[model samples]
Target: MPAEKKAYPLRISATVLEAMQRWSDDELRSVNAQIEYVLREALRKSGRLKAGMAKPMVDDKPDT
Candidate 1:
Protein backbone atom coordinates (compact mmCIF):
# COMPACT_ATOMS: atom_id res chain seq x y z
CA MET A 1 0.00 0.00 0.00
CA PRO A 2 1.10 3.53 -0.63
CA ALA A 3 2.10 5.57 2.38
CA GLU A 4 -0.18 8.24 3.71
CA LYS A 5 0.63 11.86 2.89
CA LYS A 6 0.11 14.86 5.11
CA ALA A 7 -0.74 18.38 4.03
CA TYR A 8 1.52 21.16 5.27
CA PRO A 9 1.60 24.82 4.38
CA LEU A 10 4.89 25.99 2.88
CA ARG A 11 6.17 29.51 2.41
CA ILE A 12 8.75 29.95 -0.34
CA SER A 13 10.20 32.79 -2.34
CA ALA A 14 8.76 33.31 -5.83
CA THR A 15 12.23 32.96 -7.32
CA VAL A 16 12.77 29.59 -5.68
CA LEU A 17 9.28 28.42 -6.60
CA GLU A 18 9.85 29.30 -10.25
CA ALA A 19 13.13 27.43 -10.30
CA MET A 20 11.60 24.40 -8.65
CA GLN A 21 8.69 24.47 -11.11
CA ARG A 22 11.05 24.42 -14.05
CA TRP A 23 13.10 21.62 -12.55
CA SER A 24 10.00 19.61 -11.69
CA ASP A 25 8.62 20.07 -15.19
CA ASP A 26 11.87 18.92 -16.73
CA GLU A 27 11.77 15.80 -14.61
CA LEU A 28 8.08 15.13 -15.32
CA ARG A 29 7.16 15.38 -11.66
CA SER A 30 4.83 17.67 -9.75
CA VAL A 31 6.54 20.51 -7.82
CA ASN A 32 5.41 19.01 -4.52
CA ALA A 33 6.89 15.62 -5.47
CA GLN A 34 10.15 17.21 -6.57
CA ILE A 35 10.44 18.99 -3.27
CA GLU A 36 9.87 15.78 -1.36
CA TYR A 37 12.39 13.94 -3.54
CA VAL A 38 15.00 16.59 -2.86
CA LEU A 39 14.31 16.60 0.85
CA ARG A 40 14.47 12.80 1.01
CA GLU A 41 17.81 12.74 -0.79
CA ALA A 42 19.22 15.40 1.47
CA LEU A 43 18.08 13.53 4.55
CA ARG A 44 19.64 10.29 3.33
CA LYS A 45 22.89 12.02 2.45
CA SER A 46 23.05 13.61 5.89
CA GLY A 47 22.43 10.23 7.59
CA ARG A 48 19.20 11.54 9.10
CA LEU A 49 17.18 9.03 7.02
CA LYS A 50 18.21 5.47 6.49
CA ALA A 51 18.81 4.33 2.92
CA GLY A 52 16.38 1.45 3.28
CA MET A 53 13.74 3.73 4.73
CA ALA A 54 13.48 5.86 1.61
CA LYS A 55 10.60 5.00 -0.73
CA PRO A 56 11.23 4.32 -4.42
CA MET A 57 10.71 7.35 -6.60
CA VAL A 58 9.03 5.26 -9.29
CA ASP A 59 7.28 1.96 -9.43
CA ASP A 60 8.89 -0.92 -11.29
CA LYS A 61 5.74 -1.51 -13.29
CA PRO A 62 2.51 0.26 -14.01
CA ASP A 63 -0.44 -0.79 -11.88
CA THR A 64 -3.28 -2.37 -13.73
Candidate 2:
Protein backbone atom coordinates (compact mmCIF):
# COMPACT_ATOMS: atom_id res chain seq x y z
CA MET A 1 0.00 0.00 0.00
CA PRO A 2 1.14 3.56 -0.64
CA ALA A 3 1.87 5.84 2.27
CA GLU A 4 -0.92 8.22 3.22
CA LYS A 5 -0.32 11.87 2.49
CA LYS A 6 -0.74 14.66 5.02
CA ALA A 7 -1.77 18.21 4.27
CA TYR A 8 0.10 21.18 5.66
CA PRO A 9 -0.22 24.90 5.05
CA LEU A 10 2.87 26.62 3.61
CA ARG A 11 3.80 30.27 3.53
CA ILE A 12 6.33 31.21 0.83
CA SER A 13 7.71 34.36 -0.68
CA ALA A 14 6.19 35.47 -3.98
CA THR A 15 9.55 35.38 -5.78
CA VAL A 16 10.25 31.85 -4.62
CA LEU A 17 6.73 30.76 -5.47
CA GLU A 18 7.05 32.22 -8.95
CA ALA A 19 10.31 30.34 -9.52
CA MET A 20 8.81 27.13 -8.25
CA GLN A 21 5.76 27.61 -10.47
CA ARG A 22 7.94 28.03 -13.52
CA TRP A 23 10.11 25.04 -12.66
CA SER A 24 7.08 22.91 -11.95
CA ASP A 25 5.55 23.92 -15.26
CA ASP A 26 8.72 22.98 -17.11
CA GLU A 27 8.84 19.63 -15.31
CA LEU A 28 5.15 18.89 -16.04
CA ARG A 29 4.38 18.41 -12.37
CA SER A 30 2.01 20.23 -10.05
CA VAL A 31 3.53 22.79 -7.64
CA ASN A 32 2.79 20.53 -4.69
CA ALA A 33 4.49 17.61 -6.36
CA GLN A 34 7.55 19.69 -7.20
CA ILE A 35 7.92 20.82 -3.62
CA GLU A 36 7.53 17.28 -2.34
CA TYR A 37 10.07 16.00 -4.85
CA VAL A 38 12.63 18.58 -3.79
CA LEU A 39 12.10 17.93 -0.12
CA ARG A 40 12.32 14.18 -0.64
CA GLU A 41 15.57 14.53 -2.58
CA ALA A 42 17.08 16.74 0.11
CA LEU A 43 16.09 14.26 2.80
CA ARG A 44 17.61 11.38 0.87
CA LYS A 45 20.83 13.27 0.29
CA SER A 46 21.11 14.09 3.96
CA GLY A 47 20.66 10.44 4.95
CA ARG A 48 17.37 11.14 6.70
CA LEU A 49 15.23 9.16 4.23
CA LYS A 50 16.31 5.62 3.52
CA ALA A 51 16.31 4.47 -0.11
CA GLY A 52 13.81 1.75 0.72
CA MET A 53 11.49 3.97 2.73
CA ALA A 54 10.07 5.87 -0.24
CA LYS A 55 9.78 4.99 -3.90
CA PRO A 56 11.66 7.48 -6.06
CA MET A 57 10.06 9.29 -9.00
CA VAL A 58 13.03 8.11 -11.05
CA ASP A 59 15.74 5.54 -10.76
CA ASP A 60 18.28 7.23 -8.43
CA LYS A 61 21.74 5.75 -8.51
CA PRO A 62 24.29 6.75 -5.92
CA ASP A 63 27.08 9.08 -6.94
CA THR A 64 30.11 7.32 -8.36
lDDT of each: 0.80, 0.79
TM-score of each: 0.81, 0.82
Give the Å shift of residue 30 in candidate 1.
Answer: 0.4
User: Model 2, 1-64: lDDT tens per residue?
Assistant: 6576788999999999999999887777778888888889899899999998656554323344
Query: Model 1 — TM-score against the truth?
Result: 0.81
RMSD to truth, every model: 3.8, 6.1
